[model samples]
Target: MTVICEECGKVYHVDPDKLDRYKGKNVRVRCGECGHVTQMSRLMDAAEEPAYDFEKAAAPSMPSAAPPQREMPEEPAPRPDIAYRTAGTEGRAGWLGLRGKMVILFLVIPILLLAISGYLSQQLLRQMATDITDESTELVLQEGKEKLMQKARDVAKQCEVYLQNHPTLEREDFFYDPEFSMLAVQVVGESGYTCLIQQPEPERGQNWTIWAHPNPNIIGIDDIDMIRKALGPHFEDFFKVLGASEGMRESDGNYMWKDPDGKIREKYMAVAPINLEGLPFLLMSTAYIDEFTAKTEYLKEYANNKTAEIRNINVGVLLIVIIIIGLCILIYGYRLTRSIQYLTEAADRISVGDLEAEIDIKSKDEIGNLADAISRMQDSLRFSIERLRRRR
Candidate 1:
């Protein structure tokens, strides 16, 4: 026969033959687990009815040999249902519980999102700063190129007018005349100048030559090899722009040039034709592009530094925010779950007939309302239990 303790739900197995002695009498057995008394006479009547052939076979052949006493077995194994309930309770003892899940949901997940957002924001700031710097540099370079070209055209026109006024001025005596040399050659920017150079005419056996220049040694040069030796690998790019001045049209480009100290630097060149009947000379204005873009470079560097500084500040602020959020969740969740734990323990006590369990929650939140309701229910249960006891 199987008997269960009502208060604690601990199951016990009773020998059917031992129960036959108290079959029709008011006998009771005390549960060893909880000491709750269970009347065996009611179970004995049910045990007498055979619901299956197996029970009838297991029963004692003679009822006169039954024991005179009814008692619980010394050791009883819990049923499968009891074991399953215990295992279920143990499963919730780890991080799968409510508090662990709340940390993951409100703290861990939010911090991950904040980190991702901060990374993307920093990347966007860097890209925007780079784009602005590139655009500003381009605008400054374009304006510089236009201004340099205009200066070359104006100087070329002035030289043509001066040469036409002096019709008898010979090519060999051009640089010797101070007034004509000053009109033909002039300074451009820092380490830059305008000079007169005629295009190569193989039909006349005259190579590309510089007629008037600031440097006296460079003037009247028709040797291509000497020019190539001076310019190095950048000779082709320089002449390419200079050659584009054919048909009396204007042309301009950039090329790397070797300075007197053998250092290489990027220089811009603008060519404008000097239309003096027989002279087919061109005025070339050349200057280092860095001269006009220095302020732009500085601004770009400033913008990049500012962007990095702002990104660092944002990262610090993000870390602070994550820390603050984590602290709030920890403190708030601890208090919230602590209150819940108290209510749960009180409910457990009430379920076990310990109506004296106190709910000390004082907050006027939903938890407080729930505590009040449970307190009322506990009072009603105590009152009903008291009334039943009085009647008994």
Candidate 2:
């Protein structure tokens, strides 16, 4: 499109694409020839007028002896160069520059990923701790049950030998005789004891009777109902083990036992039948199962504390990593953006014919290479201008 200086009638050729943004609006432009500001209308596709021929209009009026007049220097033509630019007249809000974008890419995204990894690691650690505790508890219980069964068998053998030596000792008189009662009642473990009980025989009017026991009140009596009342729902397990004693088979089981303080605790019991003829007595040993797994409980608590400590350390490490990354990006991004700003200002100055603009950026990275290239271009422009000045 053509724009004519209304003051000097000088014609200027303007790219139609440059006026696209001002479509349907009035715009003003300063003429390069006469500096005359002209208001252009939105109807940009007007017919091109014939260019005013200044040379032809002046030549006919000049004499052959007249000297030529020097013309004023023309302003440099505008070039559409796409480059990193700052805000013009129209600045956008919340615009993230290169540094801000870099922080999001290098710092924020990595921190999120680290947080996710840390969460998953803690969950996995908790699951592994739970599994190890369960397996260790089971292993200790198995070993304890075997030891308890062996202890019951050994005590049963001792009772059979003692009863064989005193063949005339009756079940009713066993608790009264101190020597026989001592042999029948033995200590099994810490807070546990072994006792003798007779198998049930309904035809002879006999029931589950305690012939010898650590407690004198329960000796030489039918204590089955009292035990059942104390055990409540847990009596079935104890009864099953006792019933198997009549078949001459060793029986071992676990059951809940209520203590004097109203605390319900799990207990392990083992029963071993006596081999003596005409003797329907069996030796039973019982103790709390917690006594065997006490060490395992301590170890589990220790593991939980250590796991919590390790998790704290992991959280600290993650925070430290994020801080380090943030600091690095801030330091490096600031330096990098400052160097680019220096190059931008230098380039802007050089574009306006200021060939003396200094570009002092020096580093070992790509930005340094760019600074060197721009410095060479500046030197070249200076050389070209000096050469042109000398020729003139």
Candidate 3:
């Protein structure tokens, strides 16, 4: 397309694509030939012209017949190389830029850190509970063992008195006394008793006999075989108590046994000697380790509740901190991005020959400095352009 500049009257070729922007309107542009400013108007001719195929018009209706001449397609109009571009406009809204991406990362990092912190805190709380559980169990076991030893000694003294009061009674008859049998049966824990065992009677060709037992069903039964089978790992410990009671007034020993509740735990046996003239019997008490710390379940429940509370509070606080930090970063980033948007639009207008476009923002940052520099550059460009026109 050819257009004559109104100012310079210089005829120049202008691609129709550039004039497409001025459809039904006038736009001013500097003439490439003489720097003369000219106003050009173009109408897009929107009257909806019907498209015609030139090949069809020239081909004629020929079926399976060779055509004499080939028609060539018309050449397309050349597009303009000069396009009006606003600086930063093409990339502003659709995708995240470097500045926006950095801001997003800054906000997200804190949330991840807080999540890790919350997990670590919960583990610490559970570990502390386990420690407290172990420590309290040990303390109660020690105290219970001491009390059990003292109780055995008291029962030994009562046995000595019972022997002395029944002076005429045979040792065998006294051990099976109905009053003593009732006392032994009433006692609990570890399924044991403070009773007598007699060595083998050579006169009857019999092995050692259980003179008495807390369980009446085992009374007058053979002691050795039954004791070993019933006691399991405790069989040796029982014999140790039987032999050691002759010398030591009191002693303590350990064995493994299942409790009435069906849990296997350590059982401590306390043995004390009853000093009877000719017949010696050992007074014994067996107590399970768990019996000492009966409050363990309560303690554990309380600890769990308290740990849950602390974990809840810790999580709540961490979430609050993360939210506050994220909000602050988001708000700060939004303000910074808004200021940059203003500078971008101003720069965009300047790039398209709108030198009078005001940056309009006053700030004490690098962005503000850049705005001042661009304004100066605009003035410089206008001055240089005017000087060139005057020289021309």
Candidate 4:
């Protein structure tokens, strides 16, 4: 015979022959519906007698005709301990749900903050690069321009000495002498300037070329009027700035000036009160602004390109960091959400009456601890429900 436990709903098999051994005693039969062992009197009650036998006993006074058999009602199937188990499995509304929410919130908020931080960091880096580039460009240009000015000064000094040594030739002949022209020729050659020097009294000018080859190119002139016309009034200021004296004195060093058209020029003009042969003369060397400014343009371009490259690299690094952080957050959120989903489903099952449902989580972190606590609570509730059912 199969019997169900009253306390734990465990089924047990018993032999019918054990009924005699159990007679006259309070037999402890384990309930199939629960694990509890219920005590009952060994004697069978009259209620358990067959209906035919009871009818026979009741009709004894009459002639013993066979009594009609009445149909017996079917015994109802034993109800399982659904209520107890359901009550046991019901989850307590405590910090577990809140904890899961906190986990999800923590993951999401940090990701958002990281994105904002990365954007701001990139902006700051770009600004710093730009500032550094600007400073570098300024310094390079300043140094280059200074060096070019110094070279012009040296060239002017050499030309002044040459004019002092040759003092016997006539003003016209001195200006025209190929040997004396050498100093002016060398000045323009070394100074990186396209130069033309004019001697008004000789009615002539010399154009000096210097930028390649063994020696400087020189041209002599005899047209004084043409030279004067080309010199213009600007030459007067140029000569004044150079401090040219009317006698045998040295000319001034190179002086820079901006013309009305905004072009910068360096000029060194000297005059001999008397020429090498005691004749009057003038010598001038001028270089245009393009010579110095050309070098600075390259520096500016380099600074701009370097700044752009640095900014791009910083931006790329920022993007990579952001992407990595975002992906990590997404993964964390996915796991957290999945855990919460499991907890929710477990809670739902408990609400409807399945106390044996277990909450298992893969993580070893706080969420895992929460799941463990929930499982333990379910087990405790089951124990309590079983105790109450047994007492009743």
Candidate 5:
């Protein structure tokens, strides 16, 4: 049997008995000349190369009439130019050679850049959230501190007013004064502190009984004695400032002073001297450092908890956004890669002369446009080949 390629005009000889293999298949035999694979039916015709019966044709009447032997034709030498052209032609075949590579690169680079941009954006959001959380917590703590300071000043002011109004009363008599004594008691109750109102003996500078209210169980009169001992040397200075002040002196309020027993302590004290008829008296209100320290510690704990909650909420939001962005990137990449794969497969088919292979990519994107363009090129080439064949 003889086979001739419709595409490149290459011919092959095959046994007629082997024809069954080519039936009902889309198989094409490769043409060596153009490197195109033409359909088996298009390449072969069994009737063109009939089987010969050599024995019947060569029968006996030939003994004395045998023909003279003729010179054999030499085999043609290989043409280097043809070989080079065939190799060059084969190399130019295939879609992904250069154009396809460029298309793949165009799709892949953007996917990579989008992923990187998403990661960077997530980082920036996290940093901004952290900074805002820190600043907000600090502001809360500052406000709490300011409120505590203001409360301390109010208590000090009330104590000074009581003494100035009760003139001439002895330290003991001053405590017995119902109006002033009750006022002092009320101030201590509201201040959230264990306070003592003392009127020390004139010779002792002031001797008074201490009152305890709402103590945190660890602090007491003993703590007060320790505080008084710590403020011993600063006692004169405290009285001098107290006597000179009307509204609680700001400088006096923050100063560290010593009491009679010489121990170091911070005291918020306000004193007012009174002379009632012929007696002299001074009313003094004192608060220990631990009173304000406890409130500050509570504020610190509250601030810490609030900051943690904010951080947790911020992290949750960030993670959700990151997950959404990741999913988008994954979906985008999959679609882009799938379109390129389709183009690659179509190119491979077209390379082997299957110009009927078409890409079904329907996207309106650049890759889709490229696929459409290639399909058009294939149709145009097929049309040209058909026109050339009709002319022949």
Candidate 6:
């Protein structure tokens, strides 16, 4: 017979045949684990009807008991249906009931945040790179423009030195003298050249003469209106500097032209008044803006490539980080759930009144504290049982 304690729900298996002294009477059995006493009736396994009818078998006049014969029932007796169940376990919700909720809150949410943060960082990188390049390009363009102006100043200084060496040279010598003429035709750089043009003398009915220039066809031409037209729409700016006092210089507005390749491009020019010993000369310097910006196109291309590469690398790294994070979450969640499983088993044991069962978990977390509480309860119950037995 299986007995379950009503006080602590402890289960005990006792053989009914061994309870010979308490046959058919109520007896108390103390549970070994919690010491709970339960009343149970001892039972003897006796058949309901005899296998043979004894009254019919015994005959008063039989000289000798003829060989005894036994009568059997037509059918076997029905077996009793007995089932054993632990007390207080019907309320258990089962394992894995709470782990699913924990997984969503602790694992899923953080992974989404990680991916979002990574994408945002990747997006901002391109803008950051653009800002850096823009700042550096501004400085380079300013330096290039400054260098052009300095070149103009150096040319003016060279002409001053040339005039000092030729003390007796007259004003007209600048046009025909080979040495002075070559100085004006020197190329500053590609798309840049030096030139000397004289001011218009309206009194003598003489027009502006290009005294020295890279273009031999225009050297002695007195075509004033035609020359201004060839200087393009922004020629007034050059005229402003030319008419200024000696040593004065100024920049003209940007000049637009189509090169031999037919691509529209821009350049800028500056003019300074040159008085070499009273010989009036206009020193004009011209250079294309394309020279300064030529490398900028390539730099812009490289920046684009760099941005693409960085984004790709960022995505790859994000994927790797996510994988690593997911693995860690799984490992930690498993361990946490395992601890919970221990608490569950210990609780089941206590519910069945098995107070002596060891809760071997030694952790200091919540589950361990719960086991300690159960141990305390077991001790209290055991002590109460001892006191009651002593009083009895």
Models 1 onward score TM values of 0.74, 0.75, 0.66, 0.49, 0.48, 0.54
Model 1 segments more than 4 A misplaced: 1-96
What would the per-residue lDDT of candidate 4 be over residues 20-102, giving only the tens digit for each residue? Answer: 64344544554444345444445545255454454456433655575655544434545322222222245464564544555
* Model 6 pairs whose backbones collide: none
Q: Could you tell which candidate, 2 or 4, scores higher by TM-score? A: 2
Model 1 lDDT, full chain set: 0.76
TM-score quality measure for candidate 2: 0.75
Stretch of 10 with least lDDT, candidate 5: 77-86
Top lDDT model = 2
The per-prediction tally of clashing pairs is: 0, 0, 0, 25, 23, 0
* Residues forming the 10-long window of minimal summed lDDT in candidate 1: 79-88
CA-lDDT, candidates in order = 0.76, 0.77, 0.64, 0.51, 0.51, 0.63
Off-target runs (Cα >4 Å) in candidate 2 are 1-64, 67-94, 381-392
Candidate 3: segments with Cα more than 4 A from true spot:
1-18, 21-80, 86-105, 161-166, 175-214, 230-251, 258-266, 358-373, 376-380, 383-392
* Candidate 5 backbone clash number: 23
User: Model 1: how large is the Cα RMSD against the reference?
Assistant: 10.8
Q: Evaluate model 3: give its TM-score.
A: 0.66
Off by over 4 Å in 4: 1-161, 187-191, 194-284, 293-296
Which prediction has more favorable TM-score, 1 or 4?
1
**lDDT at position 315, candidate 4:** 64
What is candidate 4's CA lDDT for residue 47? 51
Name the lDDT value of residue 273 in candidate 4.
26
Per-residue lDDT of candidate 1, residues 306-368 (tens digit): 988998898898889878978887888888888877787787556645577678999799989
In TM-score terms, candidate 6 sits at 0.54
